[model samples]
Target: MKGLCTGLAAAAVFMATGCQASEPPTQVVYRFDDHRYLELKGWDCEGELWYTDTKQGVHSQIASQFYRIFTKKFVHPSERYIAIPWWGNITGGFSVSKDYGQTWETGGASMSPGENEPDGSNAPYYDDVLSFTVVNDQGFLQTKHRLYMSSKPFDDPRILPGGSGITYTASDGAVHHIKPTSSGPAWGLDYITKQGLKEDTAQFKTNYQGLPDKVPEVKGYTGWDHMRCDMGVGR
Candidate 1:
């Protein structure tokens, strides 16, 4: 019986240390700028603002500022436009800039501020507007914990189905899910969907910090121009 016990122990040891462990599932790496994220990247800090034009090799200066005050949280869907969730004040609503940053005009009153208003909505209801994205002409803005979307840019933004990791179809007829990423924007992550099989190249990690090592064949994009669509996947 003692010999039987010893043999069992030896078998257990072999099972524990004989073979290598499997690697973890490959997760997508997202790069974004959150108030907490800018520190991880290289930038010139000034007061509450951290400015950098060459973030990950992108020609854009991000003035990381506080949520309130005159600081504007803007999103540039294209080189010709810059959109903001709040124009100037809490009730200022949204705004947009067409000719670069040369000028900005109010878009609409999607968000308003007040106290104890009806409809269970008021100043603080839609406050804390953070990241904004334009997927196929449909505008989606992520707030403190909820997602508000609009059919058009700066139009009436309404709350979408709550909770993260929920899949939804965009106005462009494409499916998207706000999945986790290692890196985009200042949030250290952003939204993405399973884009189905790779056309070329075997499966590999696409971690470029912010600059792509090679320019992909994409339309309307000049090699590393700071314009990152689909995390610079070019698809």
Candidate 2:
């Protein structure tokens, strides 16, 4: 419930907000006008990859170190893979681990110790940041701009083939559901919002197209080309 887009009308006016997709965003304005409740990042790991829970002050056995994170839900899809929307880049993109989180890949580059080649040159990036979740072996990428689905352990941040018709719709002061296509992932009831319908994927690309592609770098964090290791990329 923390990540659901709610109270947009109760907050500041939903003005003409904009952001940059290629670098860290400095102007992303949430429709709710309350940023404290947003679930901006999430992380998970497996035997092949490990991470540290800084709050607990214990590093995972799979890796010698871990990074700080604020997660809503961190789940394991398989023994060899983990996925998360690294800190700060919530809408920027996703960080994926094919080797049990020992390393992470994002924006088409490896965020680990020279683990894999960067492959996201053509991928659409987000910076209004959101969250990631898995259900029934399927990966879901949620951003302020859109919601996307992919096979578990996402290979890219782009929307999976046949991912469409997934949007937030509100009616009668409650939520509504439109059955998803076969290839589309089902929406979690928790994300339902009464403030607005069609918020999930409405004008997705159109909204992103208004933002800049290159995000400005965040100080003391990994650049767009690297894994947000500091945001808990590895175990």
Candidate 3:
């Protein structure tokens, strides 16, 4: 009887530990506003991107198998457009949304210039990308070779012509010229209020500290393990 009781107690403890171990760690990486934010759920630096919009009562996974180190999230000032550029060991792609976070489409633009061209001609090589930013509802990918800009309200971004300098017509029926030196449009995240930034920072710190020590095992072949994993916040 004593042995049976001991075995039962041990089983209960094992079950409890298993339950705790199964719960993957989660952290709020970036906050667009009080109502909208981006979270990471999985292991320490490898996970999926989950977008939450409290105002719309929407909580959905935007992208999967995201490595926090190489992935970045960009938002328009009005929160109407969001873009994510991610890279794996051998390949990389973009995931974009036009109507906020309602829906997401992957593989819109290519980091390699002219890859989208039908014949795959002109600058067929991959550009050494340095940074990506969104300004004036447009996405800009700065590379060591040249700067690539997308059209306004970037849902399906196509690399614009003329490299860093280009003249294009705005949706407002006005012709606008962008020079390499011109810097009128500011970063979309810059428009976020100070209070919002403060809250987001605090929340991130709290969530990060609470992450589990052991990374939960991901079942099945996700094909994302090759993605670069490092330590950093997804901006």
Candidate 4:
């Protein structure tokens, strides 16, 4: 039977904020690498998010508003909450509403946010940009891979806890897994070409360890189940 990681530590990526309008509307033209796919963003008078993808072969639109878009987790020293990011104007960020989304407050820190708190490890970016804001902290717009955990994990790869990032091997019994970070939030099925087998967790090591000798780049999407393996995570 398929399983999921229990407890908050394993499923913590869930989270997000923010207003309908005051500054007209903002949008993003998500033009992919393909020849003719141009995406446009818009909001209805009632403040519902909409999009239209136009291409030579396929032209389509989202018929309704998304109640909640992208989400991330938020935790203070004491309490925890989910933050939902939405779109309004061409600009986008968190939307705050006390009576659900019946009414919205535009252009606050949650909307027009600030930069993430400076971490010395975070060197300079090409540009100083703010991604999203919640409470006092801001979560930047990241273009990283989404690592969804597997249900029947021999050991959940999402949580190694404290000390430092740890590398792992799946119970699937493969040649091995090759990835960027030893640990993050995933149970990716990387195809390593090396030959070996060890079930003991102690056998896995963390570092600049390389992936298998020859593996094609991973493309497409992934879901919470095996049926959607085409959607695998990361390279």
Candidate 5:
């Protein structure tokens, strides 16, 4: 296993080569960020946010460890647009940027304080307002955790089996239960037909920290940027 991991790490380091010949318009390659690698730090899980971008003719890759709810998360279908799920306050939310790494803007309703009411007693029901997943930017998957806009807001957000993996509350915008995946950590969304709502397919491990070696020790995102749609994966 150790030898195989060493080979794979060497292979990844090689594949990660040519990730970019020249930095995109408003982008910067990791090159060397001391606090690199994915690990469970912020909140109570381990993961990272990664994204790709392409503009005019140049291409670039972006990754970061920003924390919140679904913090360390980034997916891009086209090089032009990127779907980034960043954490905010101890609470949670998201933002969008257009002009490369120039700016970012948050959206959706604003909450007063972290979980619970201002007094920390009564709490409002929360659905999957921010429970989101993207498959290379083709389509986004979200479980029905809260029914924020209906009578049954955030009723069923897909039962996240075993707390050994990554799961999401969907209501108060929380992404918990995280396991490791080959590429990174198994923190994606899995759909359940019988349940009629997207289930939190992420499974939590008993050791939790005992993750797959390939998962990488990522704490959170360090920096971020977007690529073009035409410039998909690989150069």
Candidate 6:
């Protein structure tokens, strides 16, 4: 009789520990500023992108099924324009928001007049894109072979005549130049594998000290469990 009671207690403890391990930890993926930032609520580096704007009283899932290693986001200094360059094995394109992420538009690359070759195409491939940045009101996408620039906020990107090494002003009022490279933005370098999450979490605590830790009421959040990352294979 005593042995039976001991076995039942051990089983209960095991079940409790399993339940606790299943819950994901919330993490701040990126910080646009002190009040506005992006967070992830999944295991390790796989999760969705949740935007939090404390000043505006807005918190919602702007993008779903976000993997930190593959996806990269660029926000204008003014926070008005936002772009996310997504690449996958079967499909690749850009998701752009011109009005502070109220709405989004996704499509293939559109080249300016005289930018495309006679036989070449304007379709952007996943492996062709190396890096992307938003400086001032313009967007620049650097591919494996050429550097494209769009002055009208990612409408029709054209090849830069000078081809990199040109200076431009950022949202911080600092003059900066673009250096063409063969690699994309280094994601997940500061956290996880590179720097331990403990260190990164401490830095976030210092950076966003006094900021609200409560999750705001998302207007249209159906449920985090229902959200799935189904953009492509290997996600």
Candidate 1 stretches with Cα past 4 Å from truth are: 1-75, 86-90, 98-102, 106-109, 112-119, 122-130, 134-138, 144-146, 153-235
Q: What's model 3's lDDT at 1?
A: 100
Note each model's CA RMSD in angstroms: 22.5, 24.0, 17.3, 22.8, 20.7, 18.6
TM-score of 6: 0.48
Kindly report which residue pairs in candidate 3 clash with one another: none
Cα-based RMSD of candidate 5: 20.7
Per-candidate TM equals 0.27, 0.27, 0.53, 0.19, 0.24, 0.48
lDDT of 5: 0.29
**Highest lDDT model number:** 3
The weakest ten consecutive residues by lDDT in model 6 span 186-195
Per-residue lDDT tens digits for candidate 1, residues 1-235, read 9999999999998777654332111111112232111111211211121222233332232223432222323333343344344323534444443444344443322432222133334332344656455333333454564443332322111122232333546556888554333111211112111111021110112321122122122244222212111222211
Compared with the true structure, what per-residue lDDT tens digits does model 3 show for residues 1-235? Answer: 9999999999999999888877767777665556776777777666788878899887877777754644432333335666555554212445666667787754444333233223433221233545555444555554444444443331111112333544555556788655534422222211111122232221122111232222223233222222234353332
Candidate 6: segments with Cα more than 4 A from true spot:
1-6, 70-78, 87-91, 102-119, 125-128, 136-138, 149-235
For candidate 4, give the lDDT of residue 92: 35
Measured on C-alpha atoms, candidate 2 has an lDDT of 0.31
Clashing pairs in 6: none
TM-score for candidate 5, residues paired by index? 0.24
Q: Worst lDDT window (10 residues) for model 1?
A: 194-203
Per-residue lDDT for 140-159 in model 2, tens only? Answer: 44445544444222321234
Q: lDDT per residue, candidate 6, 1-235, as tens digits?
A: 9999999999999999888877766666555557766666666666666766687776766557754533432333435665444435212334555566555544422333221322254434556655555444345554555544433332111112333433446556878544434211221111111112122222222221232222122242222211123323222
Off by over 4 Å in 5: 1-81, 87-91, 99-102, 106-131, 134-141, 147-235
